[model samples]
Target: MTDQGLGKDDKTPRTARGERTRRALLAAAAQEFGEKGFHEGSISGITRRAGCALGSFYTYFDTKDDIFRALVADMSGQVRDYVSPRIAEARDGIDAERIGLLSFLEFARSHKELYRIIDESEFVDAAAYRAHYENTAARVATRLAKAAERGEVRPDVEEVHAWAIMGMNVFLGLRYGIWDDSRPADEIAAIANALIEKGIGTRPD
Candidate 1:
């Protein structure tokens, strides 16, 4: 996995240090939760795995649930940031969907642990997980609506189409990023993009 976390490379010393510590804690928490589930995962175990003092954990997060929420927010932001620029760059192109797919697949590859935690959270708390998922889907739908207004996608297509496409990417990430790592990222993304474009993109006369 790529070291994309804000660690030694950040600008502000304090911010950088805090981000490093937070990343460490999240990494440890992901492992603990993966092995034992949320209820069984202990703060002491997470602190120990993170190699940080118990007191330090409280400085950043109040409770395990808080950390879990942070993890979800962070992962969602990462995915949005990954795809936003690519979508913006596409501007008026037919390949915006492809670019978005590749960006998402790349983010999943770099942040597999975070992705796993997000996926696992669904099974742990179905209602809360669905709420979070819907929020993310809504954001994607808004972006797609804007793109459609700009003539990047078919104008007749509804925002639900974008929600469905985002769901497809999430499931694709689960399969390629977590279940199997054999397939190339580009290939997987291309296949996904092809399906979406053919299904919803505007066709020229």
Candidate 2:
């Protein structure tokens, strides 16, 4: 079978214990790659961090590159799972974006290594890197479209608008969330949301 999406290939785990090991390896990889980077990080280091045997690595992953690819996909899914629900609880479309950014900021601040692993994926695995952002942008676009239909945003909003907001959130997460993190999450999100609220936000009657 083809390597479609994250769980691609027949090497997939078949048992509950297998899944736990895979998760441990990915978690260890995040810390390894996040700190040592893809080039410097070693498979040995991952196993050591995961407290698993050396040979056990091959049980789930074929090679170091393979694990890294899976790591990228895992991290992307983590962000979505973390932010999507908070975004859903938002009062409206514009508020949804605010919640999304706020949640992302918290995630980035806590998972400092997340950006490093993802950024390195751009160099190590271009396809996975592109897929992460493209998939995220698509989600944003869908949300915006629904918001438009519900009169939450400007009637003329388009895909470009969603991409723009996603771009904004990405950089904001990098800067305020990952880089400095001195400011409060709500404060930073509100500042960014202000620009969005006026431009895309629907006016009150």
Give the number of the best model, judged by lDDT.
2
Q: Give lDDT for model 2.
A: 0.91
lDDT of each: 0.73, 0.91
In model 1, which regions exceed 4 Å deviation?
Answer: 1-19, 91-94, 123-128, 200-205
Summed backbone clashes in each candidate are 0, 0
| Number of the top TM-score candidate | 2
lDDT of 1 at 157: 66
* Residues 1-205, model 2: lDDT tens digits: 2233344456788899999999999999999999999999999999999999987788788778999999999999999999998898999999998998999999999999988998899999999999999999999999988999999998888889888998999899999988899999999899888889875556785
Which runs of model 2 end up more than 4 angstroms from their true locations? 1-8, 199-205
